[model samples]
Target: MGRGYLTKEMKILVTGGAGFIGSSFVRCFMEKRQNPVVTLDSLTYAGNMANLEAVLGLPRHTFVKGDICDPSAVDFAMKGVGAVVHFAAETHVDRSIDDSGIFLRTNVVGTGVLLDAARRHNVKKFVHVSTDEVYGAVLEGYSTEGGHLHPNSPYSASKAASDLLALSYHATYGLPVVVTRCSNNFGPYQFPEKLIPLFISNALEDKPLPVYGDGLYVRDWIYVDDHSRAVDRVLWDGRAGEVYNIGGTKDKANLEITDFILNKLGKPASLKKHVQDRPGHDRRYAMDSSKIEKELGWRAECNFEEALAQTIEWYRSNQGWWRTIKSGEYRNYYEKFFAGRLAGSSAGSVN
Candidate 1:
């Protein structure tokens, strides 16, 4: 609720700012506030410039094409930044299953690189954006911020390590670190590999919606914009060396989400395919978000159904955006069109 820490001229360094949630935060921040932003992203398969088209050519937004694992890129992006919102990481469970090494490198070691840069640069605030999977499966009650971390998959284990490392920076060196663990995020521009987007796009194409196992694995879902707002709150007012849980207050099983998407798209149940569940799939994820609500006065503001409908409409409207990624054409398009021009340009050229 307080804006004491951020000034009008302060520039925020948002890592992974070209990705889904990061782009949402950038758009939200630009609309509500006047702070300049420097976005550092490697432009990976999931990170797309099309996702950030809204703010790409704006005067206040700067996009840097670079990886978090690169110290030079991190340092270049950290310059003159008042706050650091760390969102750069490899965040796919299936991909991690295929190759866990990249997850460890990008999530753990890359976080260390950013934290050290924040420390050396003396940034005003360092917010480490993390996930609820760090608590593994919350079978019964909610997992609080202080709950034990039981990361089952390699991706979550890497995130858990990054969370601890980010907090350790505050504990050991007083670097002003705040960590936020959020539930499943769904909204526009999400890479189709994620469950909600994947199902939506698949149903749209009249393809099979692969429902894992019995299709009953539950997760707490939050709209991406609400999660962005919560992160903005933490970036400005959160207590250092502390963790906050952010949730949507909507817990639905996998089947519920799948059925909703199929029905919403006017598709039939026969399109549902029962696939073997991935290894170590967490049964359910629930979080207690009371800390952020009570202290920061932030709560999830959007209804799940309404937000989900809006997201479906977004996909419908932006077929070219998701279709290119689905067909593997976006990579070539990106390389030929955007990547060559923006790579290491540093002027934030939108052309």
Candidate 2:
């Protein structure tokens, strides 16, 4: 790991820090380094403040309610911030399919806003947190840092645009920008809309667990803690104008994941329902993370099975947390995305 130059103030601005992965990174930053942390979040439907409750009210942590695409908001959040770790964006693919405009505005334009602010502020380091989906579906092996991006959906294409934009800042204006793309991240505090949490939550309630298409869609899984740690390492030690892949190398099919969750919950496998696949659903995704492992010495310390059980336990114990989320706009999402798809299915109507 590169020994980063110590700045006078260890303040880092984290965009989208109230979201799932963002919140996890914030927690890791606080507990690991105890540095002054400023989080900028739009508090969108998926952005819940309770995710950061553990770190709330601490002097080292401050939350700025704002949008990343708003120049004034970003400029205000970047004040006195030595570094910017960007995580703000619309991530849900189904939502992106329904509306690509938001993805473009938030992921690409918002990234440009952060880059311009970081450059104007002369921030020491800028790490852009991205996803492996930007690589699209990889049939076999893995996608390295140099792999060509072939994003298939609005969600991934927008993220790819942001990744390129962040790097361009390094090339054109000499911003010390580093990009880290990781595989699917799962752990506590993840919004229930995602795969693991959604399945776990639905299985708990006897709701139909909708598996898209054949349910064989493959995705590489990484525990959220390892991703957060790797992002920290990248922000501090990674070279400018470089991209790193952070992956746990744990790949599983959608059907396999659903079965694992249902079995773990002692639920019937009959709960699994095959729904119409979304448009442009990638066939498979895998990631190669040798760069971060070799350079930053980061690896997954959490066992997949153990961590998954812990995740299920989290949703079980925190019923109120997910229940509240599901009771509101999330229900509308289910109706909008899955309700119509499951119209003729044998499984009864879903919430």
Candidate 3:
């Protein structure tokens, strides 16, 4: 099988390009393909330009600071862009439990705005990057592209709504749109609030590692780079209006993942602390990416253990990067935004 090739003349718009996964997509597209990338990001607390510092100077890349909910912003950004990769959203579940208003507005309404723009502009394709959380907790079998949506959190519900909206546009107006629901992604340049980076940073500083509930929640992990590659493959070769599930096929319980982090950091397991679980926390999430594997021949090539080791090393050497964000300003923001929220509740510590 040969590598899939995209036409070099397409102008691509990548929303949320300053965040973790979005930044990875932008970098990969710019480095591997000969297409112009216009990054549309709102620069929310999670969307940091430092994540894209590596590709900022590239001539083929451009950045626009704007919200996805604004139709004018979407229209302005879509100009001359043949394809749109929608990645902007309020994604943290704990934060969503505090205030679902933002999530609903940004993830749902914002997605509608983009789809409307894509339809009006007749974009060649629109790729929506969604999550496995939309399927909620899956105890037995893996979630395929056609599984029922059972979103548990406000964040997941919002994403599920957006996924339907994206697909509806394809079905109704004949727009060329595809969706990718992927498993938990961890890698370099990820924000510290996410589980993997949070654990890595806290463990390195000897801070108590916070694990929600009993720390038995299971998640399938995929490296951010691999997820980005899957998205690229889907954009080029996928069938319009289809959904593709991308996962590492490596399921690890939260406790086991924490233990792996501790071992990788050469730290003792004493730092583990279990806190009260957030409301409506899903127990397990797994994805069957066989559809993508069979159609596009894309599979996660990186080993989970190796990726975990590399991620820990990244944080170890990049303390200055995360330290700046862990200061009074960030803490004050958390206090103001989510002080009495579900995630802030006091609970028993895990062994």
Candidate that would win on lDDT: 1
> In model 1, what are the clashing residue pairs, if there are any?
none
Per-model CA lDDT versus the true structure: 0.90, 0.86, 0.86
**lDDT (tens digit, per residue) of candidate 2 on 46-149:** 78777888888788887777788888878877888888889989999999999899999999999999999998999888999999999998998899999999
Candidate with maximal TM-score? 1
Candidate 3 structure lDDT: 0.86
What C-alpha root-mean-square deviation, in Å, does candidate 3 show against the real structure? 8.3
The predicted structure with the larger lDDT, 1 or 2, is 1
Ranking by lDDT: 1, 3, 2
Q: What's the residue-level lDDT of 55 in candidate 3?
A: 78
lDDT of 3 by residue, 7-32 (tens): 67888889999899999998887889
- In model 3, pairs of residues that clash are 274-350
| Candidate 3 total steric clashes | 1
**Cα lDDT of model 1 overall?**
0.90
Evaluated at residue 105, the lDDT of candidate 3 is: 97
User: CA lDDT of 133 in candidate 3?
Assistant: 97
RMSD of 2: 8.7
